[model samples]
Target: MRSLFGDLRGKIVGKNIKIVFPEGIDERVVRAAARLKFEGLVEPIILGEPAAVRNLLSSFGFADPGITIINPEDYPEYEEMKQKFVELRKGKATLEDADRLLHDVNYFGVMLVQLGLADGMVSGAIHSTAETVRPALQIIKTKPGISRTSGVFLMSRENTHERYIFADCAINIDPSAKELAEIAVNTAETARIFEFDPKVAMLSFSTMGSASAPQVEKVQEATKLAKEMAPDLALDGEMQFDAAFDEITAKIKAPFSPVSGQANIFIFPDLQSGNIGYKIAQRLGMFDAIGPVLQGLNKPVNDLSRGCSADDVYKLAIITAAQAVQE
Candidate 1:
């Protein structure tokens, strides 16, 4: 984990990437922001009342923390931000509506990213996933080719140093074949960003055509779409977990498939499997899961688990900045 962060830090150092923390008053967020700024990893723009944030910093033993703090009520550029929000909404919101929404820390922090005042934003330590993602979808929105965003975890084992990408675990309850394709392709890009050469496997209960069912067919179709979308990507599908991961099992099950025995990116059939799979890896396999990192956004905006600690915030902020550097 330390080596992983060291690599990420090397990528963003001296890049002057700016990241926003909406829950600036949260102890975890503040501590992480302070560490980020102190290390020169990224410029952290924290949203909160100046006095309150300053007091928190002091309590955290950061008497002279120089991090930027923005209070929505007293921000001088509120009008400008509101105008831009209205323009971005394109009549979905009025000035009055913008005024109400932009006062919330999440909305205000997202506006900073949308307006290019900040490179990215990270929240959800104290906010729900919806509260953090809603503003981003409304303001920053998805990239051109992507219809919706997806989340992925970069699962790494400390002892073995084995890493893999697990996708759509944080969003999309029941995606269609097209959505699953999008998730797979986007997850592949994320794998590359994290220094993995992606060999993607579209997971299913059945291996190849060993079984026939609606769920198996969905995985098959998604594999086809993903291949068409990224012809260069090394992707194969409709394989069981063992077939994807074990060399002997893969040789018996899917010997001819490109990703059969060496797949580093796994696209689950649905959110349930994706969520459960990563947790099983984290708990039983003892792999350290590093995200739910939201991908396919116009700019980076990530959500943290409510139970995340200061160190988790610190690492996620580094990952977010690394994404911005890639952008």
Candidate 2:
């Protein structure tokens, strides 16, 4: 990820992106924010007490390079933000509800991004996936024409330029065929943002009807729907993993598909499969798995693994900023 992050920093240097880190009090976030500020990657907006944040940076032998730190209780525009939150939630939340929810760092940081004070956000080092994602869905919402959001991992290996995307890994527990189709289209767009010419393979247990089951039928129905949704997309599936990744198996199992043997974006049938697949590749194949990046949001907001390192926070912040520039 070191070289990849360097290239991304260079790519987005002049874009003037600002990324919010809501977990400012976490040790990991403190170190990552220091590196981002010192290196001038992007202006990082931190949420915490100003004095404590500055002290933490000082303890790390660094000075604040003017990173924005906002305390929810002390923000001058608290009333304005409260109204915005209430309006965004329509009748679902009252003014009082908005006021209390805004005090939660994740909600406050997401509001910063939604209001254009920050271009993007990266959180979840010390929060659950739902806590990081709920505000995004409720406030930022999905992009127009997208009914759902999904998570994807950009898988790459050391000393190898082969980069593949694995999707639906961190969201959509048991997506229907319609939701699966949306994940495919949204993930393909994310692949394009990262410079992958997407050839998507929607995976199932059966490859081209070599066997039959409800699970296979779900993938098959989704492949048809996705083709209609993005006709130009190089996508085909209801296939097995081997047919998606191995040229030899693709020839025998799904020979007619233009993307069967050459897929770079893989959409799993469910969260259980997608999550386990990416971990397997990361641990066994030694691939660098760089996401769980949220797709289909109106603005970018990514979640980190709970056990993430300072380096993970640093890289995800850059990736979130890159997504900002792409928009």
Candidate 3:
């Protein structure tokens, strides 16, 4: 995990990237922002009442943290931001609506990113996934040629430092074949960002027709669509976990598969399996799961688990800045 973040830090340290934290009053967020500022990693823009945020920092022994804090209620550009929000929302939001919505920190922080005052945004330590994502979807939206955003975890082992990508874990309940294919392609791009060769495995309960079911068929179709979408990508599908990861099982079950036995990116069929799979890897396999990193956004905006610690915030902020640099 140290090596992984070291690589990301190398990319972002001198970039002068600014990342917004909406839940600036949260201890974890404040601590992480202070660390980022101290390390010269990224400029941390925290959203809260100025006096309140400074008081919170002083309580933590950082009397002069030097981090930027903006209160939406009294911002000098509040009226201009409202106009921009009205423009971004088209006819869906009037100035009256923007006046109400932009006061919410999540929406306000997202506006900061949308208006290019900040490079990215990270929240959800205190907000739900919906609260963090809904504004992004409505404002930042996805990149061109992508329909919806997905989340992935960069799972790494401790001693060996083996890393892998697990996808669709934090969003999308029951994706269609098209959406699954999109996840596979997007996850492959994310793997490359992390310097992986990106041999992708579309996971399923069946391997080379060993079983038959609707779920298995979905994997099969998704694999085909993914291949068509990225013919250059090293991807194969409808394979069981063992077949994808173990050379011996690959030889027996999928001898001709391009990604068999060497796949580093695993695209799960749905949210249930993706969520459960990463957790099992984290607990029993002892892997360091470093996300549910939101991908396919036009600009980067990541979500933090409510239970996350200060270290988690710091790492995700680095990752978010790295994504901004990549974009």
Better of 1 and 2 by TM-score: 1
Residue lDDT tens for model 2, 148-201: 889999898867777899999998999999899999998898887677788999
Cα misplacement distance, residue 38 of candidate 2 (Å): 1.7
lDDT of 1 by residue, 117-186 (tens): 9999999999888888899899999999899999999899978979899998898989999999999999
Q: Rank the candidates by lDDT, best first.
A: 3, 1, 2
Give Cα-based local distance difference scores for all models.
0.92, 0.90, 0.92
Report the backbone clash tally of model 1: 0
Cα distance off (Å), candidate 2, residue 63: 1.8
Off by over 4 Å in 3: none
User: lDDT by residue for model 3 over 1-327, one digit each (tens)?
Assistant: 878888889999889999999997898999899889989999999998889888888887788968999888789999999999999999999999999899789899999999999999999999999999999999999999999999999999959989999999999999999999999999999887788999999999999778999999999999999999999999998899999999998999999999899899999999999999999999999998887799999999999889899998998999999999999
Q: Which regions of candidate 2 fall more than 4 Å away from where they truly are?
A: none
Per-residue lDDT of 48 in model 2: 92
Q: Between the candidate structures 1 and 3, which one is better when assessed by lDDT?
A: 3
Higher-TM-score candidate of 2 and 3: 3
True lDDT of residue 275, candidate 3: 96
Sort by TM-score, top down from the best: 1, 3, 2
Model 2 residue 62 lDDT? 82
Q: What is the TM-score of each predicted model, taking all chains together?
A: 0.98, 0.97, 0.98
